[model samples]
Target: MQPSLLTSNASHRQYRGPITTAIFDWAGTVLDFGCIAPVEAFRQVFSDAGVPITIAEARAPMGAAKREHIALILKEADVQARWQAHTGHASNEADVDALYKEFLRVDEINVAKYADLIPGALDTIAHLRARGIAVGSTTGYPREVMKNLIPLAAERNYKPDFVSTVSDVARGRPFPDMILANALALATPDVRGAVVVDDSPTGLLAGLASGMWAVGIAASGNEVGLSLAEWTALSPAEQQAHLTPARAKLERTGAHFVIDTIADLPAVIDAIEALLAAGERP
Candidate 1:
């Protein structure tokens, strides 16, 4: 389903260092600290539908396209049971489509309110740009949401060189389409020369499946699942306890590296370049 990290006959071929582009997932990776907007909207949609799914259920399918995300959430056993009990029938495709429409309306309305850039997001992008590394972005958000969100971010001087949305591609998270689209649009010298910085395991898998290095974001992203204020309110030990499993979860996704947030990304980029210099593949 994806290009191999290495060509069969090119085992001797080596990648050079200093990387080219860094692709980012939008919500938690760069802005909206805990990826709150979508989850809130998801919950609202379900509640409006009389199912009233929990936050965990809403967040469970966070990295897929909104419609696909709605489909995944509806596929949850408990959600299905609740749906049946509430409506006296199994949820069908029409329910999915209707809920997705509501999700779009709700999320698009709320996304701008959560568009604040994650701490160090702008700094990290600046640092990468200074070193001639192009910064690109991919997201599960559709164009309607981006229409509101992008200007908000740009108004704050945080804009990626390229932005690819779920609607821009045939498939979204856990699939390589969005990530590869970023690399291809950037004209990256090689796939391995690009990095994917994501907060979700699904996004990291997409990056790896695209043959790009992946850096998982733990604390500032979904794995920690806390708002910036809520996160900062925690004592050091509290945060540490959360990050342990967060790191492990992303690590299990086969990410080449994992760090707290985008602020910690530049150093990881340098580390990945060292691997590239040694002819290592992500």
Candidate 2:
């Protein structure tokens, strides 16, 4: 006998409870002001290859698995033309491998340097915990890169209850595996009762794919492209100039809410609870 369709729907239940988990992306979303480490590493690798890329090009595929990130850059039309001109051939897996090796080397050294918790990240997590939310994290970095980072971040009071890295999943963001891993580790009741907070469109896409609320961090992260101190030093007009495009990009990518930094997260969580109370999902 065949199984009933109801059996499939049985495990597809939605939660009516208030949000129970807040899964965050690590670098830009929680630590490393302005998401500098990986972007710098990316720039270094490409420049060393004699095919330098602008910071914008380096950041264009932020939040993907490192190899996938390299692949995406290689696929860019201008980058592809440059690579062919430089190497006399189109980029391939070997080129990706070479770039990734350089990236890993540069990133391992720099990741610890940038491990300082973004201002207000610790307090925000504490506030979330006080509200009974379990905090989990996902990172584009593999476990090896995170080995130093996890401990460094914890020492700085920015630890999450659980962390899932690219090594822990078959695929990284724009795929839901990392966030699902967080939900499983946190024992979240349903995807509907969770939030995914990140600083990249790929991360937001992961949340949307997981049927969870997607919160984008704008000015304090990749989009604004400034260190915390640099951002603070900007005049109000300059700040607005950075924020307008960043916020628009996040909204365009389907973030349910966008805030400048983690410091603003607690209030957003409060608003999300109210929406949940109104029977909204995601």
| Per-residue lDDT over 48-167 for candidate 2, one digit per residue giving the tens place of the 0 to 100 score | 999999898999999899888999999999999999999999998998999988888899988987887888898999988988999999988988899988888878877789999999
Report clashes for each candidate as comma-separated counts.
0, 0
For all candidates in order, the CA lDDT equals: 0.89, 0.89
Misplaced by over 4 Å in model 1 are 1-12
**Cα lDDT for residue 75, model 2?**
94
**What lDDT would candidate 1 get against the real structure?**
0.89
Give the least accurate 10-residue stretch of model 1, judged by summed lDDT. Answer: 1-10
| Candidate 2: clashing pairs of residues | none
For residue 183, give model 2's deviation from the true position in Å.
0.6
Q: Whole-model lDDT for model 2 versus the true structure?
A: 0.89
My TM-score estimates for the predictions, one after another, are: 0.95, 0.93
